[model samples]
Target chain A: MEDNGRTARKRAQILEAARPVFLRNGYVGASMDEVAALASVSKQTVYKHFTDKEQLFTSIIMDTTAQVEGLTKMITATLDDDGDLARDLRALARGFLGAIMEPELLRLRRLVMAEAERFPDLGRTWYERGFERSLKTLAAAFGRLGERGVLRLDDPELAAEHFVGLLLWIPVNKAMFRGGNDLYAEADLDRLAEAAAGAFLRAYASPDTA
Target chain B: MEDNGRTARKRAQILEAARPVFLRNGYVGASMDEVAALASVSKQTVYKHFTDKEQLFTSIIMDTTAQVEGLTKMITATLDDDGDLARDLRALARGFLGAIMEPELLRLRRLVMAEAERFPDLGRTWYERGFERSLKTLAAAFGRLGERGVLRLDDPELAAEHFVGLLLWIPVNKAMFRGGNDLYAEADLDRLAEAAAGAFLRAYASPDTA
Candidate 1:
């Protein structure tokens, strides 16, 4: 029974170790041996848990889908609470920045970007898990904004895409891509989120709307 | 005289061949021998023309810079023409779309983005040359918009960033990043450009301040 418990724990450890290796090495550069070594598991054990690199990486990203979930759920509820628009947006931005800034998530994004050329499937998965889902959550927020009459938007979905598009370059420059200016400090984050939300409201808010 | 002419011609060929090779292999993945072979020049001649790989890439990007110049120059002149904001902005968006669609430039952008992780200098150069310069041009256009009193003013630079930021993601995903979207045909360019411009103008134009 103790040995069975140990095996279960070992399987989880291997999966966790595989995440960084795949992120750091990408698809082509990464190897199973390195992941096993990192996990302190035998080669056969890795095979038992994951049939292939793609499977392992896909599971890695999906399992960590929890990372973005907290921010999404938090913002959706907060955006509904009728807090000030600028304040709400800044809070939302902090959540987003905090989530992406985690060393693990940052590495995951880098790995997806690096391997995007050869194994575009990984990039698509990352986009689906990260951007697509986030956009849906954001659209829900916009829907609330519409209901509040703070903005009259014909299509919250397109508006959400436009809003999130502004931030795509932000992460690309600051973290994964490197050599982008320093990551945002607290004040910088506050300023950018406010400016962005303000501009978005100004542009999208129907004249008679919010 | 014959040898000198042949050498100059060979140098041009090497640069030309380099675009395709660099696009496919990435900066580090590319090799001089392959470039020499593709150019139909001796390795010695390739070396004679470029001191090293970095110089070679810089030269290729410099060549690409010329391609970006004419479009913006035309837009700036058109924007300055009695502040014809509509025509000017339409032309600018079309120009941007046209620039974004060019196959070679698109490939160069992807190559730079992919290789940027390992080579931070390339990312800086790309941002300075491609992103910053383009922003400056847009700011000037917005300055003209303000001069015409069609728009209210804060920071023209930030306004310009927002303007371009709106359309930046689509082509980047389609052409450069290969995120699996069909490229827009030439016929739809102006229409697509105009819609985005109109949406932008609505948010931006100071209550029909014109």
Candidate 2:
């Protein structure tokens, strides 16, 4: 049991250390030597945990999909209740914006996109496991809301897509192209959240509630 | 006069050949030798036209901005008329979607985003010249529509942002992450365009017009 715990801790350390290296230098440029040095482990130990650089990078990306679970849970908890749909949506949008805009997350996203052509499977898996997974979860939650008379929608899935599209398109593109988080102030994101939620509500809220 | 025309033709040939090289190999991997060979020009000719790889790549990106001029013109022609607002918006959405989804443009977009960190200036310039330039033109058109009571909006810029956010968030992200054009069929994009336009009109159209 102790050996298992120690192995798990070392794996975590290597992943944590390797992430910045990949984010900084990209896939082809990243080196296992640097990852070992940053993790305070020998290169042999690094290779033992992950057989190759591809495995290590794929592991780091797959790990991020777990983070999306929190957002999915937030969707169910907030929207599947009787709370004001607009306010709940704003809160959800704020949460999503904040989550996606994390400096680390943004850098990881850029790295993945930069390497997508070279590593097509990595990009597709990340999309399915992280991006599309959240949208699917959000769609289910919206379906529930529609049933409860909180929203009106012909297709719950399309509504979920539009809700996020309305919220994330501008700021995310700005950040992706500019390559940093400083482009948007907290106030700017808040206003974006409010505006997106308002627009979404105008489009989806029940006629009586709107 | 003939000498100047010859110089211009050589410059255009080099730019055309260099684009695919950069797009295929990315900025770091692209070679000037391959560009010269592809263009049927000598290495000296390539250098005489553009001082370095960076200049060549930047020139190629800058050249694509002229394409956005067509879309902006379409926006005015479609939205500025006293025609049906929803139908016009769909046509505009279809035009915008078709333009952005061109296989070559998508590839260029991926290349620019992939290199954004290393070549921050290029990314910023492309975003400003290609992306924001179109949005700004669309915003001015929307503002005119608001004045003519075709649409109701307090902030035209925000309205424009919402407009694209609704339209582009899904398909663009899908294309960006998946690294190919075959993921979405033309019928799929047409349906997406229709959905986006319908939602945008619901959010912004005047009550009487809606």
Candidate 3:
């Protein structure tokens, strides 16, 4: 059991080291020797943890999906708040932007999208596991809001899409193209979040409820 | 004057040939020799027209921005229609989606975004020239609609962003990640466009006007 625990710890250490290397160098340019060296482990141990560069890259991406769990929880907690719908949604939008617009997350996004052509399966898995999962959770929350007459939507899933679409489309595209996160100030993000929540409310809020 | 025309024609030819090569090989892998050979022009002629591969690539991207003029015209003509507002908006939405979702355009977008880190200026220029130009035109049209009391937006720019966000967030992201345009059928696109227009109307249509 102790040996197994030590092996798991070593594997985690390798993945921690591999993330920045892959982010910096991209898949084609990244070298196993560099990853092993960065991990302070021998190439054999790196190979023992991950069979090859592709496996290591895939593991790194797949592991990032776990971060979405925090977002899922945030969505549930924020939407479930029995407060002002607009206020709650704005806070949720801010949280959504804050989580997604992290420089590391944005870099990972760029890295995944940049290599999506060469690694179709990795791209698809990342989109499904990371992007779609969060959408699904938000959809469920919207459904609950609709049931309570807090919102008026024929389709909760579509509303969820609109909410995120309004919030993310401009900032994410700017970040993706500009290759940086400094484009938007905190004030700008807050304004964008407020605009998205306001638009969503206008589109879906129960006419009488608001 | 005839010699000047010929020079211009050769420049055009070189640019036309360079597009596919860049699309296929990306920035790092593309070669001037391949572009000249494909254009059936001499390498010396290619050099005379374009100083280097970077200049050739930049010119190709900058040239494509002219296509947005056509879209701007389309938006004005479609939205100015004296017919049903819903029908007009749906037609506009459909056109917007069809234009942006072209495979060649998607490929160009991927090419620009992939090299965004390496060529920050190129990416910024493309985003501003191509992407922002379209949004600004759409916003102007939405502003006209607001003046006529057809829409109820206090901010036409935000409304334009929401309109595009609703229509494009899902499809564009899917294309960016999956590296293909086959994810949606013609009917699916129509439905998406319809949904976007519906949501936009719900959000912005003058309560008494519609």
Per-model DockQ against the true two-chain complex: 0.40, 0.79, 0.76
What lDDT tens digits, residue by residue, belong to model 2 across residues B88-123? 999999999999989899888888888878888888
Angstrom error of the Cα, residue B132, model 1: value is 1.3
Residue pair clashes in candidate 3: none
Query: Which tens-of-lDDT digit does each residue in A128-208 have in candidate 3?
Result: 999899999999999999999889988988988989998999999888887666888899999999999998898889988
What range of 10 consecutive residues in model 1 chain A has the weakest lDDT sum?
A: A172-181
Predicted model with the maximum DockQ: 2
The better-scoring model by lDDT among 1 and 3 is 3
Residues A42-152 of candidate 2 have per-residue lDDT tens digits of 999999999999999999999999999898898889887778778889999999889888888888888888787888888989989998998999999999888888788
Candidate order (TM-score): 2, 3, 1
- Model 1: lDDT to the true structure: 0.69
Q: For each candidate, what TM-score against the reference? A: 0.86, 0.98, 0.96
Candidate 3 local lDDT, residue B66: 95
Candidate 3 per-residue lDDT, tens place, B140-197, comes to 9999999999999899999999999988998889899987668888999999999999
TM-score of 1: 0.86
- The CAPRI quality class of candidate 3 comes to medium
* TM-score-best of 2 and 3: 2
Using DockQ, rank the candidates from best to worst. 2, 3, 1
The residue-by-residue lDDT of candidate 1 on A1-210, one tens digit each, is 999998778877988888767665556667999999999888988988788877887778767766667768876886788767767766776666566566666556555555556666656666767657877898888987888788677778767756654544444443544533356676766666665666677777767645
